[model samples]
Target chain A: MTEFQAGPLSLSFGRKQVLHEVRTEVLRGGTMTALLGPNGSGKSTFLRAVAGVIRANGPIMLDGMNLARMSVQEKARYCAYMPQLLPPPVRMSVVEVVLLSLRLGGNYVGASAAMERVDAVLASLGIMHLADAMMGELSGGQRQMIGLAQALVRSPKLLLLDEPLSALDPRYQFIVMDALKRETVLRNMVTLVVLHDPAVALRQVDSAMMLRTGRVIASGVVEDIVTPEIMAEAYGVRARIERGSDGAAMVSVEGVV
Target chain B: MKERSNTESVQRALLCRRLLIIALLLSGLIAAVLWNLVCGASHLPLDLLLKALFSGPDDHLEGSAGVILWQLRLPMVLMSAVTGLSLGLAGAEMQTVLDNPLASPFTLGLSAASAFGASLAIILGLYIPGLPSEWSIAGNAFLFSIGSAFLLEMVVRLRGASAETVILFGIAMVFAFQAMVSMLQFVASEDSLQDLVFWTMGSVTRADWTKLTLLSSVFSAVMIWSFRDSLPLTALRFGDDRAAGLGVDVRRVRLAALIRISLLAALAVAFSGTIGFVGLVAPHIARRLVGEDHRLYLPAAALSGGIILCLACLAARTLVPGEVLPVGIMTALVGVPFFLGIVLRREKTE
Candidate 1:
C-alpha cells in the first residue's frame, strides 16, 4: 500500500497564522482517516493546504511526490477535495456534472466512455436513478451525494472531503461513509474526511487525527486518542467513551468543562 | 428490446428538436432578409426583389429595383445580420464569464465607451491625421472599446478576478463613459450634435462592402475561437471554485473570454454604432430554447440575435412608411417590454 505524509505544515491568512507545524500521516491507500477537531481549529485550513487549494509551508507528500510543486491540473489528477459548501447549483444534469469533473481532470475518455464512467459512479453511490435529475432541484443531502459522485469519478489517489455529512441525515451519513470506505478499500485510495461527531468517526473510520488550535494534538488508533481526558482538553467538554449496542466506541459528553 | 427502442426513441426526439430549431432559424433568416429587402421606403414586390437579387452585377441591372437592392438594401441587411450574430455570441460568453443573465456589451459599458469615442470624432473632429475622415469615427470607437476592456483587465489583476468584481467595474465604466458622451453632446454644434445623436441611436445605413467584409471576417474568426473553447466555457458556468477544482485555469479562461468579447463588441459597435438589446435579449431567449449547453447555446443565441435585429430593421423601415425611426429605438421599445415579461413570469414561478 501507499503512504501519505504531511509534515511541519504551516499556513497563514494575511498576518494571522491559522495552521502551524501541523503534521499527520495515514496509509496512502485502502483506508479512511477521520480528521477530528473543534470548530476554528484549522482542520479545514489544513485540508485545504493538502488539497493545494491554498499554499502552505512544508511539502505534502503523496507517494513521495511533493504536492506543493505540482500544477493545479497535476494535483487534481492525484487528489480531489469536496468543499463544505457547494456553489449555487446551475441547471445541469447530475451525469453532466460528473462528466465535467472527469473532463476537468484531463481524463479525455470519449463521450460514451465518459457517460459509462458517470453511470458507474452514480450506480456505486446508489444515485443512478437521479442521474437525469437537474442539480438545482436536488435537496442538500442529494447535492452532497452529487458532490461525492463528482469527487469519486476522478478516481483520485487522495480524496479530501470537508464536512461531507453535515447536510445528511442519519441514513445518508451511514450510506455515504460506508460507500467511502468501500471505495477507498476497492481503489486503494486515501480518504481523509473531516468529521465533527467523534462517535460517528469512531464507528466509521479506521484511524483518526485530532487537531486543536492549529496544532495536531494526537494521531493514532481511534480508541487510544479519543479518551475522555483528550476530549476534555481538545473540545473543552467532560466526556466519556462507552461501548454502544453495536460494540463500537461512542463518545458521550457529560457537561461543559 | 424495450430498453433499446426506448433509447432510440429518445435519441430520435432529441435529434428532431435540434433539427427543428435549426430549420426555424434558417427560414427566419431567409424571411428576414427578404422582408428587409421588400419593406423599405420604396416597396419592391417579392417577385421584383427576387429578380433584383438574381439579376447580374450592379453595372448590368435593368432598373431602379436592381439598383436599390444592389446599392441600398443588400449591405444594410448583411450588416444587421452580422452585428446581431457578433453581439449575441459575445453576450453568451459574457453572461457565462460574469455569471449574470443580464450582462452584454451594452450593459458592460463597452458600447458606451465606443459611443464616447465616436462622439469625440464627430463633435470635436479629433481624429488621427493619417486615416480618412470617414474612418475616424469607427476607428476611434474601436480603440476606446479595447481601452474599456483593458481597464477591466487591470481591475481583475489588481483585485483577484471574480464575477461580482467584473460586473461592478463594468457598470462603473458604463456610467463614466455615458457622462463623457453627454458632455460631448453638450459642447457640439447643432449639425454635429444631430450626427452624434443618430450614431448613438445606431443604424446600418453606413454599411458598404469594405466594412461588411472586415466585420464578417473578424466575426467569423471569433466565432470559431469561441466554438473551440466551448467546453471550458461550459465548465465556467458552475462557478469559479467548481471550475478550478475541475482543473480549469479559471483566471486564464475568463481573461481569454473577456478579450474576445471586447473584440467582438468593439467591431460590432464600431461598424454599426451602439446597437443595444439584441446582445442582452437574444442569449436569454436562446438559453430558454436550448438549455445551458454552450455548444447549442452559442449558435442558438447567434440566430436569435440575428432574427431580432432583422425584425427590428424591418420595423425601423416600415413602421412609419417614409420616415425611418432608428433601429436601436425600435429594439429598446420591443426588448424592454419582453424583458419585463420574462422577469415577471420568472417571479411568478418562483
Candidate 2:
C-alpha cells in the first residue's frame, strides 16, 4: 500500500549537468523496477539523487512524506542505498558489517534484537555461514552479497541498489535477483535497481526506465520499454526482443548501432 | 536453529576474546606504572613504596622516600601516563578519520609546531605577554600547537576535508614549521641552543601537578566524546560513501574527530614536548591486539600508549644510572625496532 515518487530532479557537477529535470513514474511497493542506460546516462546519479546521497533540485515523496526536505539521516530511515562498489575488505566480520546499518539514524535497536535482524537478513541471502567470517577474507562476490545484506538489514521502505549484481557470477546474479524479488514482495517495499543487462531486466523486473544523456528515453512495462528503437536510442546498440516458450520477453543484442 | 545457536556462540566467543585482551592490556599498564614508580634514581623498595603510597602525600612519612614519591616520581609517572593515553587516543581517532594508518598527531604538524614554539621560547625568551617566565616554554608550545590545529581546520574547511587534502596540507605545515625551527636554531646562542634541543628531546622530568591535572581533565573529556561517536567512527572504516549511506554525517564526524584529536594531541605535546612514535605505534599495537571495532580498539590503544610511555620512562631513568636520558630519544629508539617488527610481521602475514 506504499507509494514512492521522485520527479523533476536536476543535478550538476560543476559545469556539466548529470541529471536534467529527470523524473520517475510512480513506483509502487511490492515490485522491482530496472534503471537501465549506457555510460554517462545518469542512471547512478538519478538513483543517488532519489536516495538523497547527493543533493538534487526537486521533490521526492515517499508514502506522502517529502524526502527532499529531509536530512541525510532522516532520509535513511525510509531509504536503503547500496552503492555500485562492493564493500571494501576490512577486518570486520560479515555480521559486524551488517549490524552497522542498525546502529545509527536514531532507530537504535537493542543488542539481541539487532543480532536477530542481522541473522535473518544473512540467512535470507543464503550467506548464513559467512556470518562469522572476516569481511577481509571474503571474495568479491561474497563481499557484494554482504553489501546487499547490509542494505536489507535496515528494512527500509525504499531499496535503492546501484549495480548490485555487477561483480556476481551468473549463478549469483540469478540468486541475488531472486532474493531481491522475494524480499521486495514479502516486505512490500519499493525497489529500484540499476542494471546493465536489458535481458536480465526483461526477464526479471516488472517495469523499466530507460535514460539517455540524463533524460528519460522511455518508461513503461518491461515488455514495452525494451523495444529495439528505445535500445538503440539509449544504449546505441541494435537489439531484438523475442518471446520465450514461457511467454517471457528476452532481449538479444545484435551489434553496436 | 542449530546454525543460529552456533553463530551466536561464535560471536560470544569473539566478544570474550576482545574483553580478555583489554583486561590484559589494563593489567600490563598497571604493572608498567608500578615499575616506573620504583625504577627511578633512588629505588624505593616495593614495601616502602606501597607504604608511602598508602600514607598519602599530605602525611609526612619517615624518609626521603616520601619526598621523592610525592615530588619527583609521582608527578612524572602520572604525566607520562596521561600524556601517553592522550596521544594514543588522538592517534587512533586521527588514523580512523583520515583513513590512513600512517596518520597521527605528529603527521599533522602539531609536534613540529610545538618544537618551533619551544625553540622560540628557549632561544629568544619569546612567550605570551601575560604568562610567567617559568611557564613560558609550555605555554608557548601549547599556543602554537593549538594554533596549528586551527590552521589545519581552516584548510579542511576550505578544501572540502578529503583525506588526501588534509594529509597533504598537514605535510606542508610540518615542513614549514620545521624550517622555522631550524631558522631559530641557526641564530641561537650555544647555551640556548642546547636548552632548546633538550626541550625538543621530550622528558617528563619537568612534570608538575598543575600541567598534569589540566592534561588529565582534557584527556578524560576527549575520551568520553570519542566513545560517544564510536559507532559512527567504526562505520567510517567502510568508506565515506558507505558510511554516509548508513545515515552518518561524514563531514560532521570528521570535523568533530579533528577537534578532539587537536585538543588531546596539542595538550600532550605541549606538556611533554615532542614525544614521538607513541602516537604512531600504539594504535598499530592495539589494532593487532583487539582488531578495529573502535569500542574496544580505542581503550586498548589508550592503554597501550600508557604502557609504552611508562616503559620509555623506565628506560630513561635506568639506561645510565644517575643520568636520565631524554625519554623522547628512548621512545624513538625503542619504538623504531618494535614498529619495524609489527610492519614486517604484518607484511609476512599478508
Candidate 3:
C-alpha cells in the first residue's frame, strides 16, 4: 500500500510563522483529499511543504521513504507539485510542453504510457483542439488545465495542487475537480488539492483535510467531516449541513461561514 | 483553435529562421572576404584585389594593394566580425539565462570595466621600440579586462537580487569603473593621449590576422560550450519554483552561463575597446524574429550581429570619401533609432 505521511511540519518565513506544526497523511489507492481552509490559513504553505519545493524542517515520508533526505531527481519521479501561479511566457507549444513533462527515459511509475495518457487527459479536459497551440496564447482556464495536465504527465504517485479553482467559473470548477477525482482513483494515486469552495466536490472526493490557523482542524471521510458546526467554526461564520434524503452526500452553505 | 495556430506559426517561423540563418552565415563569409579585399581608400578593382590575394606574401601591385589587403584591411574585418559575434551571443545568452530581456553585457558594466582596463594599459606600461620594430607594452590589459567582468558579475549576484536589482548593480559597476578610468586618464602622458583616444573610439584599422584567429577561437569556444544549456534556460522561463519542482539545477546553470558570457564579453571588449549596441540590438532583433527560445536565439543573434557590423564597417569606411571613421560610433548612431522604435512600440516592459 502507498502511504504519504507528514509529521508536524513547521516552517516560518522571515518574521512570520506561516505554517505551524501541521500534520496529515494521504493513503495510496484510497482517498482524494482536499486541503480545505479559508484564505491565509496556511493551507497553501502546507501544500508547498508537502511538495518539498522549498526547505523546511519536519518528517514528510512517502511509502516510508523520508522526503527530506531524497535527492530532487529521486523525488521528481514519484511526485509533482503545481504552484498557485503559473507564467505562460515560456514560448513553448502545448505539445512541446507536454513532451517536457514526460520522464527523460523511464520512471518509477508508468513512464512509457505517458504520451498516450496525456493526450487522453487533454481531450477529456476539452483542450485537445489546442494540442498545437502555444501555452502563451491560451485563455486563463485553458492554461491552468494545461499546467495541471503537465504535472500529471509523469503519472506521479502523489499530486499536489494549490488554489486551482479560485478564479475559474462554476462549470470549469466542476469539470476540473471531477476529472482530477476520477483520474486519481483510476491511476490509484493520492491527490492533495487546495480549494476555497467544496460545492463541486460533494460527489467526487472521498476525503477532506481541513485546516484552521495552521493546524489540522479535521480529517476523515468526506461526509463525516464537512459539517455545519465545524465549517462554521473554521470559517468563523454560520452554515447549515443537512444530508440529502436519497443518501447522496451533499452540503449546502446558505449562511456566511 | 487560435492557440494551435499561434504555436504552429511560432514553430514554422523558427524552422524558416534556421534556414535563413544558414544562408546568411554562408554569405557572410564571402562578404567579409570581398569587403576586405575591395573598397578601401585606394579602391582596388576586383581584378587587382584577386591578384593581391593569389600572389605570395610581401608582393603587391605598384599601388601596394597587398599592404591594404594583407596587412591592414584583412585583420580589421576579421576582428570586427569576431567582436560583433561575441558581444551578440553574450548579450542574448545573459538575457535568456536571467529570464530578463533588459539585461545586456554593455548595460551590465562590462564595457566600463574594459575601458578602465584599456585606460590603465595606456597610462602605465613599459614600452620597447628597437628589438623588432616593437611597440609592445608591459600591460597585460587582457587579464585586467577579465578581472573587471568578474567584479561586475559578483556585484550582480550579491546576497539579494531580483533581475531589476541585478541590472541596477551593473549600472553601479559602470559608474565605478568610469570613475577609475577618469582617474587614469588624468594621469596619462601627453605622447600616449593620442593612442588612448584612437583606442577608445573602437576602430578596427589596426586589426591583424594573428589577433583575429585568437579572438575567434576563444569566443567560438565560449558560445559552443554553453549551447547545451539553452533548453534549461528556457525551462527557467516557467518560473523558478516550477523549474525546481522539475528537478532543475538552477544554480549550476546560472553560474556556468554567467562565467562563460563574462569571458566572451571581456575578450571582445579588450580586442575592440568597448563597442556598444551590438550586445543590445542584436538580441532584441533576434527575439522579435525568432521568439524567446534560446536554442534558436543565440546563433541567430550571432549571425545578425556579424552582418550588421560588416555593413556598418562598410558604411564607416566609405561615408566621408576621404577620412575613415570608427565603427563603434556608427553602431551607436544607427542602433539608437532602431532600439528606440522597438522600445517605443513594445507593449511590455520586460
Q: Estimate each model's TM-score.
A: 0.88, 0.91, 0.81
Docking class of 3: acceptable
Model 3, stretches more than 4 Å misplaced?
A: A12-18, A29-31, A38-41, A103-121, A166-175, A196-204, A211-217, A222-257, B1-33, B44-63, B121-169, B191-200, B345-350
List model 1's recovered fraction of native interface contacts, to 2 decimals. 0.37
lDDT tens per residue, model 1, B46-99: 998887788754654557887788878999998998889888988898888877
**Mind giving the per-residue lDDT tens digits that candidate 3 earns over B34-151?**
8755886888888887887788567765357777777777788777877888888888877766665666777777777766666665566644445311123212344554565556
Chain B TM-score of model 1, please? 0.87
DockQ for all models, in order?
0.42, 0.71, 0.35
DockQ, model 2, C-alpha based:
0.71
lDDT for each residue of candidate 2 in B244-288, tens digit (9 for 90 to 100) = 788888889887887788777666766777788898898988888
Candidate 2 residue runs with Cα over 4 Å from true position: A242-252, B117-172, B188-195, B337-350
Model 3, range A83-174, lDDT digits (tens) per residue?
Answer: 77754645656766765666421352353345456566676667777876767788777777887777777777888888788767777777
Those runs of model 1 whose alpha carbons end farther than 4 Å from true positions after fitting are A224-227, A230-235, A253-257, B1-16, B55-59, B121-172, B341-350
Fnat of each prediction, in sequence:
0.37, 0.73, 0.40
Give residue A248's lDDT in candidate 2 (0 to 100). Answer: 80
- Candidate 3's clash total is 2
Score candidate 3 by DockQ.
Answer: 0.35
Candidate 1 clash pair list: none
